[model samples]
Each structure stands twice: as structure tokens, then as C-alpha cells.
Target chain A: MAFINYSAREINCKLVYYGPGLCGKTTNLKCIYERTANDAKGKMISLATETERTLFFDFLPLALGEIRGFKTRFHLYTVPGQVFYDASRKLILKGVDGVVFVADSQEERFEANIESIENLRDNLTEQGFDIAQLPWVIQYNKRDLPNAMPLEELREALNPTGKIPEFEAEASNGKGVFETLKALAKLVLAELKKGGK
Target chain B: MSLTPQLVLLEEDQRQILDVAERLVRDANAKAVYLVDKNGQLVAEAGELKGIDTTSLASLVAGNIAASGGLAKLIGEEEFPTHFHQGERDNVHITLVAQRIILAVIFDDRSSLGLVRLRVKKAGNKLSELFDAIFKRAESELGDNVESPFAEISEEDIDNLFSD
Candidate 1:
């Protein structure tokens, strides 16, 4: 859900990064936190286990400048991608305004990618949100890997509808990170514009 | 097309919420009080906020509530309406108001949990009424012919935000 505070003249939206375990969901958030300017971003909080895997979620509050005089702030979150953390994932999606599914591109991880998407669908339904109607995008991450599957193959398998926006990213180096964010933010803003229409 | 209700806080309603929060802070003898949306957005806050990071606190509080609520369902309860965390120097009392927002009170050794809880019950009732009115206004406004502030936004405007 988006929060529009006319008193503060700010628009706040929540966006979640989701995928299978070790699919670079947290990497995507870390890259954004490192690259954003200090004044444009708030402290990034990560609740991770001792080994650095996300235990609950990673949160980054980013100010993406102003639109129509209201400061647009995006709260970026990443679900624990590990399958057993399904409950945690549902909690994070409670008031989500948008979703970015970070699919691992390695050929060996194709099955995991499919399972994660199915899981995403089921979880969204459980939360009373229809995945197709939400402003969501897909990111083919780890594109630099030697075992990375072809983009076309991944798309055919994952994005059968060929409607949602997709980006190829190597999140560790920040490639396509901002592009994917910009696209999702745009879609969210467009949805907000269509209020009650 | 968004199925979820968007939380829109107008100027007038914001002031009312802050007034209640300020009163709660004084009555409970607490260090600070905060009204946060279930989505982790800080709605209004009062008292000593100088050293506090309200943004991070709001997000963490919402996460805590969410996790706790999930636990409640696991044990066959509808929800856990109240949560308290005590520390050596400071303590917190969290209550779910109207099932849509969180009212949190942070206190120190100066105040007791009993006092905070008593005051929070009254404050929560007032807040619930205010929020109920706010939601009604939002629904009516949506039904009216008022145009959205974002109606004038263009693709170029969105692109300009990322131009830097």
C-alpha cells in the first residue's frame, strides 16, 4: 500500500525483492544502498543471520526525487528467499506496493527459479493480492556468471505472458539495478495516478 | 486498480493525530509516543525525538507486529493486540489500534508500565475513532469527482526524476 502524507508532502511506497535462496535478492538492495547519495537515502537495515544470509529482510529507504511537488520515497525490502522462510515472506508482502522477482540466471538454477515464481504466486494470492494486477517486474540476475542461461530461454520459461517488464542484471557490480528500480517506480506512480478510475 | 486501500493523511487529520500522541506522551509520562501505519509509515510522533531514528523504528515496529501476528495465528489466536519490551534503561509498549495502525509508547525509569498501559488504552480509543473517521472521509473522497494530484504527471516527469 502507498502512503500519501499531504501534511509532509511525501509519497511512500513499499517494494519487495523476492526469489529463491542465493538468487541475489539482498545483493540487489546492497548495491542500491551503496550507490545512492547520502542525502537521498536513509540508513539501510539488514536483519541477517550470522553467516550474512537474510534472516527476515533487508530494508532500504530511498528518496527518488519529487513528482508533482511530493517527495517520492521508496522503501525497498528483500524476502529471505530460502524456502523455509515462507512465513517471513508473507509478512513482508502485507502492504507491498510493488515486487521485483530476482531470478538467478545460471542454467543449473532454472528449476529453483521456476519454483520461486510459483511460490510467489501462491503467496501473493494468500495475501489477497493478484500478482497479475500488481505493478511488478522481473530481474534476471547473475547475468555475468559463466553458467548463465540464455535470456530468451529464461524469459520463455519464466515470463510466459511476455507482458511484465524484465531486466538483465549483474547486481554485484550494479548493472541494470537503477534501470529496474526506475521502471518499477514508474509503474507504481502510474498506478497511483489511476486512483479510483 | 489497486485493491488495497491507500493511506492518505490530510493536513487536518495529521494535526489531530499528533495532538492525541502529544497528550498520550504527557499523560503516560513517557519519553515518546508514535503513531505508525501497519505498512511501517510514520503517521505522527511526539516527545523526545532528538536522538531517535523514527524511520527505522517505525519499520522495525511494523515488522515486529507482523511477526507476532503470524505467531498468533499459528497458535490458533486471531491476533496479539498488545506487546511490551523492557530494557535496562528504556521500555516500550505497543498496541494495535483498529487493526490498521500501531500506537507505541517508549518510556524510561521515570514511568512504570502500569501507567503507560492505562494511558495507552484511553489514547488508543481516541485514535481508533479518529482513524475511523479518516477512512470514511477517504472513501467518500474517492467516490467524489475530485481529481488526483498525480493526474498531471507525465512520462517525462517520471523520467526526469532519474535523470541525475
Candidate 2:
């Protein structure tokens, strides 16, 4: 949930990145951490295994400057995307304000993408958050792959509801990364404007 | 369906929370005291926080408490009201207060966990009362004379956030 502290005049929101294993969820966060200026960002913490796979999560707190007179801070986190880590993923979604589903674009990983999306929907539903009504965005990551799936096919299969904003990205090179974050952040702010907080 | 949980702490309420946190540090001789929402948002902090990332601490503490809550439910318990972590140098004691908020005390060799827990118990009650009053005030005045702070923010203002 987004936390608005009136005493401090600050707005804090949690945004989680989720997808199947090796879907570049963690890479998306690392790219943002590198590109952000020092003054506008905080320490990036990764709880990972020996091989650097996210064991629990990767947290990066970014200050998107300010809006009006209040400081607007976004806490970005990535859930461990391996299928066996479903329990960890559910815990991370507890109070999430927004979500970015980073789908692997390789054609061979199509089924994995579908299963992960289903997993996301089921988990979100358990938390009483309907993805259709939540501030949601989808990133078809790893677009630079030789045999990446077509954008239309991916959209049809993953975002069949056609209600979410989607972005195409090559996360390692930092392409379309900010655009996805900015879009989701905007939606989150819009939701708050409705007194949804 | 809620974008964020509105933390409507008036200046006086904030002062009260800070005062209690400071007392917790003094009585327990702890390194720092942090009050966070169950959702991982840092509500306030006190004491000599030199190298601590309070934001990360708040988030991770909330996560730990949450996972513990899940375990409690699995075993047919209402909730695990408290969790204690004993590190070599610094030990942390986390307790639930007012249902949705958590109070955490980080202490070391200067004081024992018994002292910290005793101080936390007293301070936690004071905080619960303070927060309860704040919530009541928000409910009464929220939509009447006082509008939401975000009401005046324009689309341009939001768009400008990412311009740089």
C-alpha cells in the first residue's frame, strides 16, 4: 500500500516487479539503480543466493524528486521469480501499491510466461487485489533476443484483458526501463488522487 | 483497492511518537528505535542512527513480521505478537501495537533484552493511544473542512516527476 505521512509531507509507495525465473526482473531493478543519480536514490539491497539469483527480493528506494510540496518516494522491489519461490512471492505482494510483470520475450519461454501470469493473478486475488483494477503494467523484456515473441502475440496471451499498460524493453541495455516505471508511477499517483489512499 | 494507507499524524501526534521513541532508546540504551506500519512504511524513528538504512530496515522488518504472521495462521494461532532476533552485537525486538503498526527496538550489550522489552511495553501503550486519537481525528475532519493533500496535485505535476 502507498503510505502518505502527513506529518512529514511525504508519499511512499511500494512497487513490485514479478515474473518467471530468468525473466530479467532483477536486471530491470539493477538498471534503474545504475542510471539513477546518487542524490535521488538510496542504497540498493539484494537478498540473493550464491549464484546471485534473488533469494527473497531486491529492494531499491528511489526518490522521484517531489510533487507539489511533498516528497514522493517509490520503493521498488523484485520478487524471486523462480516457480519454487511462490511463497516468497505471495509475501512480497502483501501491501504492494503497483506491479510490473516482466515477461521473458524468448519464444521458448512462452508457456512459462503464461503460468507466471496465472500465478500472479491467483496470488493477487488472495491478497484481495484484482490486477484489472490495480495499477498494473507489463514489460515484455529481453526484446533483443534473436527469436523474441511478437508484441501482439505476447500481449494477447498475457494481457488478454487489454486493461494494462505494456512496454517493450531490453533491460540489460536500459531500454524502456524508466518508461515502464514512470507509467506505473503515474497510475499509482492517479489512484491516490481519487482518494484511494 | 487502496492506493496507500493514509497516515494522518498531526504535528503534535508526531511529536508524541518521537518522544516515546526517544524514551525507548534512553531506557533500553538501544542503538535505535523505529516505528513502522505493517506494510513496511517507516512512520518514525529515534536515537543515534549512524549507518542504518531505516527505510530498508522498516521494509524488511515488516516483511519478517508478515511472514511470521503467516506461520502463526498456519498453526491455528491468532498471531505472533512479538519476534526477537539476537545478533552477536545488536539484538532486535519487534512487537505489534494497535494491530497494524509495529515497534522495533535495536539494542546491544549496553542493555539486556529484558529491559528493552519492559520499556517497549510501556511505550507501546502510549503510542497506541496516540495513534487511536489520530485516526479518530482523521475520520471526523478528513472530508469536511480539511481536504486530502493530494487533491490539488495536477497531472502536470505528476508528469514533471519523471522529466529529469
TM-score top scorer = 1
| Candidate 1: Cα lDDT at A174 | 97
Worst 10 residues of 1 chain B by lDDT: B139-148
* Tens-digit per-residue lDDT, A53-160, candidate 1: 999999999999998899999999999999899999999988898999999999999999999999999989987889888999999999999999999999999998
Q: Residue B118 deviation, candidate 2, in Å?
A: 1.2
- Record all residue pairs in model 2 with backbone atoms less than 3 Å apart, i.e. clashing: A1-A95, A2-B4
- CA-lDDT, candidates in order: 0.90, 0.87
The prediction achieving the highest lDDT against the true structure is 1
lDDT: worst 10-residue window of model 1 chain A: A188-197
> Ten consecutive residues with minimal summed lDDT in candidate 2 chain B?
B1-10
Model 2, range A47-155, lDDT digits (tens) per residue? 8999999998899999987887789999999999999888889888878989999999999999999999999999999878887788989999999999999999999
**Candidate 1 local distance difference test against the native:** 0.90
